[model samples]
Target: MFELIGIPPQALFGQLLLGLINGSFYALLSLGLAVIFGMLNVINFAHGALYMLGAFVAWFLLQYLGLGYWWALVLSPVAVGAVGIVIEKTMLQRLYKLDHLYGLLFTFGLALILEGIFKHFYGVSGQSYTTPDLFKGGTNLGFMFLPYYRGWVVVLSIAVCAATWYAIEKTRLGSYLRAATENPRLVQSFGINVPVMITLTYGFGVALAGLAGVMAAPIYSVNPLMGSNLIIVVFAVVVIGGMGSIFGAVVSGYLLGLLEGLTKVFMPEAANIVVFVIMVVVLLLRPAGLFGRER
Candidate 1:
């Protein structure tokens, strides 16, 4: 393979795995963004910060309380969601009446503050998370030796993405959510509590980010800046996938990951920018995104 493309198949698959792992983060993060935007119409620029916060919260839990990954998996989301609730009640709630940009700007500023504070204390150097003992090793297949953690991330991300899609698309709660978001007056007249639903929806969105962060903590360094670049890629992914479609976001995310992987094998230099290029092409082809309904 390297004879022809100047890259070995092993290296290619490794990058592909990297892309897929990155895509998992993108899918999870974007799903949260989509969920928040789908119902609340607020672009949560604080999502990235929230993700980083989750990792720190997990780290603190482990370091201070001797909690393990299982506990972090359970506790981190709750902590992050609490902060999200505070943010929503104190700041984001006020901007709902204004232009959508206000929410975005406010959240963006909040992200900067949160990230800056964490950096001030933790600095740019990231801390390491020990991989769980159960997921510590790799599996040898004929083609490649698959790292257990990477494989777990991909599988778990897909499961989560699928579950979210089903909940939003199939369940009664999802029906109310969609109805409320589409027309709060009508939904309220129908006796659903739109305000509470909106709050939970936001919490759910932030919780998803928290979960992603915890999953990421072991794989990547626990750093304040982790969310910054990842969030940008995820935003591009959401834009390309059609913000309205949960399933679309998941599928596009994984697909782009594979594509990025292939690019590394065939064209090394273009690998980094391939996702953005795809986003551009996607936007050109469908301004509303692949699954988005035209307004």
Candidate 2:
């Protein structure tokens, strides 16, 4: 019976829910980017490729090992994180002291190679991961029908994002990470193996991206290009949130998603570019980003 600007509540709320779901993915992926860039100072352009790898890894577990979603949820990230560790130790570390451009270029090239390999085999038709048995139903919300899996996604993603924020902003290990990034030699003097710590931090960040990928498998068609398609927007999110600002990344992701959802209902023509438009505005006003500190 109630409508805002002549638009039905169901349509508006549905778009909001959709925005929240997308924001969850954006938060997860951008959180990883924030961590890696914040702690390691590496501009990881391969993040999307790594995300794509996570989805494929989940698919592989399901198709080849009969592992199912739950197992893939755990294993895919671990696998991707391990790959991240290798990347850090073998290659990424070497460029730490160099220009940020180098790291970006190296990772970007790596992403291309990875995407090419997968595209060659998969042919980009895409694969689908079925919703788990426990999450295949829908709930009537009086106004809108909400799918169980979509609700699960929103809750779990918020939990994960909250947990990550707490870990980095409140805990002792988080302090150490912050310290090491600020002055590795000082932290090393405290007997912390800074290199190892940095390595693990990068791994953990990559794992977050992988976790996002696995969660997305059932909702979006699993394809080699999926990560690439979504990643540019994620990068925009990180920039708007403030590069390397953990809290900024989380908040910006959800905020942008909601804004995007609103745009879809009010002005469908601009929905696609709304996020970027916001990014441009944010940059013009505060180049450092909404939550980023000026160095």
Best prediction by TM-score: 2
Worst 10 residues of 1 by lDDT: 1-10
Give the alpha carbon lDDT tens digit for every residue of 87-186 in model 1.
Answer: 8877788899999999999989999999999999999899889998989999886557888988999998989999999999999999999888888999
Assess each prediction's global lDDT (C-alpha) against the native: 0.87, 0.93
Candidate 2, position 120, lDDT? 95
TM-score of every candidate: 0.95, 0.97
Measured by TM-score, how close is model 2 to the native structure?
Answer: 0.97
Lowest lDDT block of 10, candidate 2: 1-10
What number of backbone clashes does candidate 1 have, counting pairs of residues 3 or more apart or in separate chains?
0
Q: Find the candidate with the highest lDDT and give its number.
A: 2
Error of 1 at 271 (Å): 2.7
Candidate 2 lDDT over residue span 1-295, tens digit each:
4364778877778889889988999999999999999999998899999999999999999999999999988999999999999999999999998999999999999999999999999989899999888999899887678889989888988999999889989999999999999999999998999999999999999999899989999999889999899999999999999999999999999999999989988889998799999999999999999999999
